[model samples]
Target: MTKKNLLLTILATSVIAVFAIIALMPFFFLFISSFKAGSEMIRNGLQFKFDFQNYNLANYALIKTERDGIYLKWYLNSIIIMIIQVGAGLFFSSLVGYGLAKYKFRGRNIIFILVLMVMMVPVEILILPLYKEINSFKMIDTYAGVVLPFIVPATGIFFFRQFCSGLPTEIMESGRIDGCSEFGIFFKLMMPIMLPAYGAMTILLAMGSWNSMVWPMIVLRTSEMQTLPIGLQSLLTPYGNNYDLLLSGAVMSVIPIMIIFLLNQKTFIAGMSAGSVKG
Candidate 1:
């Protein structure tokens, strides 16, 4: 490569590195602050200065012994809900998307348009009606209530539709010629080819479900049923805040998302690139 191109590449890399560091700064502050006592943290606030005297494992230890380890219960609840949301989201959303992408049927364009319209409408606008529906079904404070409304996300459907549109339809025709059922073709043939899409969607769906607060808070009435975000927010009240458990728990809550992103990092980029260009 020419020196001009090389210089440009270096400059671009430097800029990206700076932005990445800026993005990570909050998590860095949260990690270090979790080691300090509540009073010290409030007094000192988030700072670059590292004082060994102010730091301890007390916050983390409190997570284990405090309130009979209710923090762990919250963590488990979030995990279960995330799992259900991601699995169901992928299954139903992809089915709808694949049908729209590959099938020639009436009202297909109208259905896709409807999906886009729903995507444009913010979730906040639907919350009231969703809550009422959940209440009517007597699913309040249950996992179903938390996971049902958003199981087939409009965004997921749009994404999968775009990706599947670029796929060759010959394979699908071949499956039919082999006497495979429609479900068999989708599950066995198309699904394997859609792995990159699945990987990308898995991370997206997991993050959405894990970080969800408002919906779960509305649906769950009991403390034991609360997800991590709700549980952490509960630490803050009009009287005082429990920074001790709050900071440490928040830091730990980030672990699962980081692990998921790392695992799917390769497929994520590919899937995103292909989807962007395809449709």
Candidate 2:
């Protein structure tokens, strides 16, 4: 490469490295603080210095044992909710998106327009009516209540629609010529074709469901049904706070997200790039 090109590349790399450090600083401090005693944390405020004497596994152990291992229960609840939401969201939303993208039926454009409109509206604005609807159905404090409202996300539909729009209709015609059913073509043919899209949506849906707090908090009145976000908030009391358990639990809660990203890194990147260009 020319000298000018080499300099530009080095400059870009340095800028990215600097931003990466800035982005990761908070997480580094969170991990470090999780190891420190509450007193030490209060005194030092996420200092870089590591005092081996002040660090212990007591925080993690306490989290595991606290309230008869309710933290595990909350973690499990979040996992179950994430799985159900991602599965249902992918299946139903993608189907709707595909139909909207490929089929020409009465009111198809109207439905797509409505989906777009819903996407523009903030979730916070709909919370009141949604809570009332859930309450009327007597589904409050149940897992269904938490997972149902988000199962067919507008954002997922829009994403899948854009992705599907770029796919060839010839494949569907080929499947029809082979005497395959519509659902079969979708499940067996299109699903594999849309793996990247699924990967991208999986991360988005999983993260949203896992980190959801306000809606779950509103619907789930019982402590046992609470997800990690709500459960973590409960760690703070008016009398005293469990900073060690709080910070440690927060660190542990991030594990599944990191694992998801690591597993789908390639597909996710491809899906995002393709979707952006196609959309």
Candidate 3:
């Protein structure tokens, strides 16, 4: 490569690295802030002395009517909602994607395009009408009301389809010749091969479900039903900021995701190969 091109590449890499750091700065600050006294965090600069007593779980007590926290309820609610939607999302999408990839059908292109078209539409456009429909069905403020609408995604189908398309047809044909039923072949053989794709899919679905806000906020009316994002929003006072409590809340919201990712790391990396390089 020419010196000019090399210089440009270096410059681009440097700029991207800088931007990545800038984006992550808030999270780094938030983690550290949770460990400091509220007064010291605001009044002093970034470097505050560590004090375990200062960082007591009392910050989380703001949400509790009792000992632990009402935040715990929100956390549980979020987990339940996430479990339902992501499970449904992955299951339905994978079924459809597998069919599309493996079978030849009339109007296949039409259906695929229709699914892709959904990606073009902004979610906000559907909100008002969706809310009205939910209300009409008397589903508002319920767990089903919050999770049902979000239980499917065009992208999940697309990802599964892409991954399945890359799979060799010889395997399927071999399974058929061996007198393997379609369900048996799919579940026993194909599913095992699709682990990497499922891993990536799980990560995407879980993170999105965990962080989902606007729709949940719209559907969940009562404090009892609020999820983590909604609960954190409620923590923001009408008065100025409560730094320690805010930091603690942020940590509570973030730590679970980190732990989940860490625990499932091998699978997550395997999943990252979903639509990419084959084994």
Candidate 2 structure quality by residue, lDDT tens digits, 1-279: 699999999999999999999999988888877876655666667766766786777788867787888889899999998889989998898999988888889999999999999999988898999999999989999999998888789999999999899887877888899999988888877877788888898889889999999899899888888999999888765334477678889999999878987888788566433322231
Clash counts per candidate, in order, are: 0, 0, 1
TM for every model, in the order presented, reads: 0.90, 0.89, 0.80
Candidate 1 per-residue C-alpha lDDT over 1-279 given as tens digits, one digit per residue, 9 for 90 to 100: 699999999999999999999999999988988888766667766777988786889899978887899999999999999888999999999999999998989999999999999999988898999999999999999999999999789999999999899787877888999999998989988887888888999998999999999999999999999999999999865333377899899999999888988998887676334422233
Model 2 — which ten-residue stretch has the worst lDDT? 270-279
Better of 2 and 3 by TM-score: 2
Task: Give candidate 2 misplaced runs (Cα > 4 Å).
Answer: 2-8, 39-44, 48-52, 270-279
Q: Per-residue lDDT tens digits of candidate 3, residues 1-279?
A: 699999999999999999999999878877867665455666677763455555655555654533256677888898898888878988888887887888899988888998798867777888999899899989998989877776768888889999899887777887899999998888876887777778778778889889988888898998888998887777565444455566677777887777767766687465444432344
**lDDT of each candidate versus the true structure:** 0.89, 0.85, 0.78
Ranking of all predicted structures according to TM-score, beginning with the best and ending with the worst: 1, 2, 3
Reference-based TM-score, model 1: 0.90
lDDT of 1 at 205: 93
lDDT of 1 at 160: 95
Model 1 residue pairs with clashes: none
